[model samples]
Structure formats: C-alpha cells, structure tokens
Target: MTTITRRTVEYPADGLTMVGHLALPSGHDRRPAVLLGPEGTGISDLQRRRADALAELGYVAFAFDIHGGRWFSDPEEMLARCLPLLADPDRLREIGTAARDVVLAEDRTDPERIAAIGYGTGGAVALELGRAGVPLQAIGTINGLITGRPGEAAHIRCPVWAGVGSEDPIQPAAQRDAFAAEMQGAGVDWRLTIYGGAGHAFHHPLDELPDQVLLPGVGYHEKHAARAWRDVLGLLGECLPSSN
Candidate 1:
C-alpha cells in the first residue's frame, strides 16, 4: 500500500466554518484530484475513509463538509438544513466551489484533472458545480439525481454518471426522467443506473448511525453500496486516470 498523508482543513463557507478532510498520495508530484461530498448528515468517517482510499489510488481527495463541522443526528434537523440548500443552486455552487478551491490550493493537486463525486445532498452539490460551469473532468452521484434550472446543464462540460435505487421514493421515476431529459436536451454525456430492490441512501452505511437518524424510505444495501463504489471507481478511472 502506498503511504498517504491525511489532514483536516478549515475554511469558511455558507456562513460557517467548514472543516474538510484532505488526503494526498505519498509523492511530491501533482496528481489528479477528486472532490468528495458527503450525505446530508454531514461529514463522517465513511467519507474520510473514502478520501484515504482515493489517495491510495494515487489521487488527492478531499472530503468536503456541509453543516459546518456539526453532524446532524436528528432527522428533522438534517432535513431542515439540507432541503433548503438543495433547492438553492447558487448556494450549492458556493459551497461546492469552496471545497474545489481548497483542493486546488494543495500542491499535490492537478487543477486541470479534478473530478467530483457526491452522495445524496452532496451529489446535488456536485451537479450544481457542473451546472455552474466549473471545470471538472467528471461528475458522479449516488442516490442524488437532483435536476437543475432550465438550460443550466448545457454548461456541464464533463461526462456524468448517476446511480440510484429503483425504489427510491426521494428521487422517483419522474425525477429521474426529468434529469435524463435535461441532460439529453443539453447534449451532456450522462448515464443513469438503477439498482433494483434498493431504496434511498442505499449506498450509505447505517450501522454506525443512530437508530433515530434513519429517515423514512432510507436503508443501506451492502451489495449495492459495493457496486456503487465500483461504479464510481470506474468513472474516475475512465475520466481522470492517475498519472502514476
């Protein structure tokens, strides 16, 4: 295994002090980078581990934070904070851009070769970045099929891959179709994968979370989670291969 360095980075975003996790491969040379976004509950060890895993693959990865540095264990609180943020594209772009800038500031990052992968609310943020015309090599989202404003998708220059549970009530078929229509109309290279028998947040692990934190129609599917990770890796490998 390659040695990697990990650190906590602090920055200001959305009227709060944001704390993000940064992981870098063991080398002084610049490498492709990924901006990782977490679920609405905020940053967790799961996201940090993902950053480390990306670093092992020879890419700098930064797990960006939402909800400041606080993890919302209360379902209502989480929804209250995330729902509004999801509805506002400008706000989402502000936050996602903040994280992107932080990763770009790192000496190990190849600014021209960065991508974004986000889950749930984080996925929406990644989409927002693409919609805002941020220069990204690729965009991948799991259980976050949120669409953007009219004609905004035309600004996305990178290929997009989204994965979601077929039975996800939070993002039903209508929403998925709308997202597809938007991407198609904008001529963006995009694809969607529907995992059968899974529900919202299927890619998110719930074992370490509190019982009360499980929102309605949300459950983790271990098989699909692993599959989603593989799919994400494939997307990254295809769109932003490591220089090493």
Candidate 2:
C-alpha cells in the first residue's frame, strides 16, 4: 500500500500567508523531500497529483504555492499574477527561501537531500534558487525560462536537469543553447533534454489548450512527454539519496 498525506502550510513571508500542500511518504524515515513549484496557474489539481505521485515514490514532497492559493483559468490572469513576482528578483528569492525552509522543517524530510522542481514560471524560480547558491541536491525545470542573464551561472553548486520542448516558443533554441554553454563554462553539472515535437506545458494535459502556444507549424507530442518524465525521475533519483 502507498501512503500519502496532504496538509496546508502557512508560509509567513512579507506579512502574507502563502498556503502550500505538504505530502509525506508513510512508513519512511527521513526521506528525501522535493520542493514542487506550481506553474503560472498556481497550485492546481495537477500539481497536487504530482506531489502525491512523489509521495508514492517514497519522497516527502511539498507543493508550494507562490500565488497565494488563487487559481485562474484565463491565460492573461495567470501571466499577470506570475509575471510581477518573476520580475522582482528579491521577492522571488524570499518566496523560494521560505518554501525551502518549510520543507526542511519537516522531521521526515532529509535536510541534506532536498531538491526542487518547477514548471514554466515556477521553473525559473527553481533555476534561480540553484543560481543563488541555495544548498540543493538537484534542480529540475520543465518548459521554463531563465529570468536573469547568464553571468550568474557560476553560483550553481548542484546538478541541474532542464526539460524543454523543441516547439516551445517561449524558450528559443538559441537561448537554450546559450544557457547550456553558460552552465558548461561555469563548470556546473547540467543536462538539457529537448523534445523534438513537444510544445510548452507538454506534461500538463489539464491545460485548456496545450497546443495554443504552438508555433505556426509546431505542436505538442505525447511521446516526448513520456520521455521527459522518465528522464526527470532518473535524474532526481541520481541526485537525491533514498531513505532506505
């Protein structure tokens, strides 16, 4: 039987209480914890499902909400809510730090084995956390963009795995190549997997229109989504130690 628990945490930052979902693996001691960041839509059912799936894999997972528990169906609203925080570097750091602390505070979580994974805007936060010298075992970003320039790449101290879709217009091939070069030049352990036919939010089937962000001739591919998911799980297992 798989054990999973869900609870809300109030992250007191900047005088606001940001609610988050914490999922723990039952019958485990000091398991590695993963900080799960939501996409631009905040903490949706999909994010919660991901956390539960991680818990089933024997990981304590925290799906942290940067959007203060609000959900929006409109793309414009999602962008409006997420863009301001992404634009402000300081707030972004504060929120990330707060979420990291929340996961670390759990007794069942292994302090030294914490990793972070995010999608889209949340992916930027995960990358920023690693770049800001946060003590993380690994960082994974899916269909996300890097906010700052490439100069800060030297500060990353852990392995990074980035999954991007070839059809993702938000992240152009040239930019991804530049980012990979920067990571390599900084001597950072990094790997980037580009899905040849996938578009943005490839893993998220719940999106009203997954192919809406597709280019004039590009669209999402299901095969790439499966491949990316497998790669992410393998990378996380490699970076984070098992409780057993």
Candidate 3:
C-alpha cells in the first residue's frame, strides 16, 4: 500500500472557522490536487476518508469544510444552515475559494492540475467555483445541487461530471434538465449519470450519526456508490492524468 499523510487544516471563510482534512501522498514530486466538499451536514469522517483514498491514488486531496467544525445529524438543523448559504452564490464562492486557497498553497500541489469534487451541498460549492471561473481541470459532483443562475455556466472552463440517484427528490428531473440545459447553452463539456434503483444520497453509507433521522429517499446503494466513485476517478484520469 502507498503511504500517505493526513493533517487537519484550519481556514477562514464567511466569519466561520473552516476546518479541512488534507491528505498527501508519500512523494516529493508535486501532484495533481482535488478539492473535496461534503454534504449539507458538513465535513464528516466520510469525506476525510475520501481525501485519504484520493491521496492513495496519487492525488493531493483536501476535504474542504463548511459549517465551521460542526456537523448536523438533524435535517432541520442542516437545512436551516445550508439553505441560506445555498441561496447566496457569492457566499458559496467565498466558502469554496477559502478552502481552495488552502489546497493550492500546499507545496505538494500541482497548481495547474487541479479539480473539484463535491457531494450534496458540497457539490453545489464545487459548481459555484467552476461557474465563478475557477481554473480547474474537472468538476465531479454526486447528489449535489446543480441549479445555476442565468449565463453563469459560461465561465466553466473544464469538463463536469454529475451523478445522481434516479429517484433523488432533492435533485429531481427538473433540476437535472436545467443543469444540462445550462451546460449546453454555455458550450461546456458535461455529462450526467442517473443510477438506476437509487434515491437521494444513495452513495452515503448507513447513518452513523448519533441523532440520525431516517429520511425517505436517502438510503445507501453500495453498487452504485462504487460505480460513481469509479466514474469520478475516470474523470480525473481523463482530465488530470497521472503523468501530468
């Protein structure tokens, strides 16, 4: 197994202390980097693990944080905090940019070979960064909010890959159609995948949250999760190749 290093990184954004998990592969050579965003509940161990996995795959991954250092198990609590942030695109840009600065400042990161990937609300931030004209090689989102403002997608400078559950109420057909239409209108290279037999947050493992509420249409599907991960890695390989 390839050795990797992990560290907690603290940053600032929107008057909150954002704490992210940064993972680096064991090498001196600069490596391609990814900025990872978490679900609306905030940065959890799940996203941290994804950072480690990306590091093992030879990329520097920083699991960017939102909600300061807190995570919500209650949907109401999460929505209360996330809804307002989601509504303001400039605020979202601040959050994504703050976390992104941390990753880019890393000595081991290849500044030109960077990407963004996010899940749920985090995914929305990734899109925000892209639409804000961030120079990323690719953007990969799963179960993310794909809604965009008018003419904003024209700034996207790289490919985008989005994966969502077929029955995801949070990202129903209307949202998907709107996302696609925007991408097409902007002449952006994008693809969307609808995993069959899956619902919202289907990639999430069983809830380990202490006060977890079992929400409808938000269950795990192991097979689809794996498939989506593979698709994400594929996007990275195709965009920011290892040999870069």
Clashes of each: 0, 0, 0
Task: Give the Å error, residue 45, model 2.
Answer: 1.0
Q: Which candidate, 1 or 2, would have the higher lDDT against the true structure?
A: 1
Per residue, candidate 2 scores C-alpha lDDT tens digits across 1-244 of 5867888898875347788889988884789989888777677777888888888888999888877777666667777777787777667778788999999899998888889999877788888888788899999988776745566778889999999888777788887987788788888899898888777777766454442343232344668867877887887889985543
Residue ranges of candidate 2 with Cα displaced over 4 Å: 147-150, 207-220
Candidates by TM-score, descending order: 1, 3, 2
Ranking by lDDT: 1, 3, 2
lDDT of 3 by residue, 73-155 (tens): 88888889998988988998999999889988999999999999999989999999999999999999899856778999999
Q: Candidate 2: lDDT of 201? A: 76
| Cα lDDT listed for each candidate | 0.93, 0.79, 0.90
* Model 3, C-alpha of 77: deviation from truth (Å): 0.5
Candidate 1 lDDT tens digits, 1-244: 9999999999999999999999999979999999999988899999999999999999999999988998988989999999999999999999999999999899988889999999999999999999999999999999889999999999999999999999899999999999999999999999999999999988767776855467778998999989999999999999999855
For model 3, the superposed segments whose C-alpha errors exceed 4 Å read none
lDDT of 2 at 4: 78
TM-score of each: 0.98, 0.89, 0.97
Alpha carbon lDDT of residue 216, candidate 1?
A: 79
Best by TM-score: 1
Better of 2 and 3 by TM-score: 3
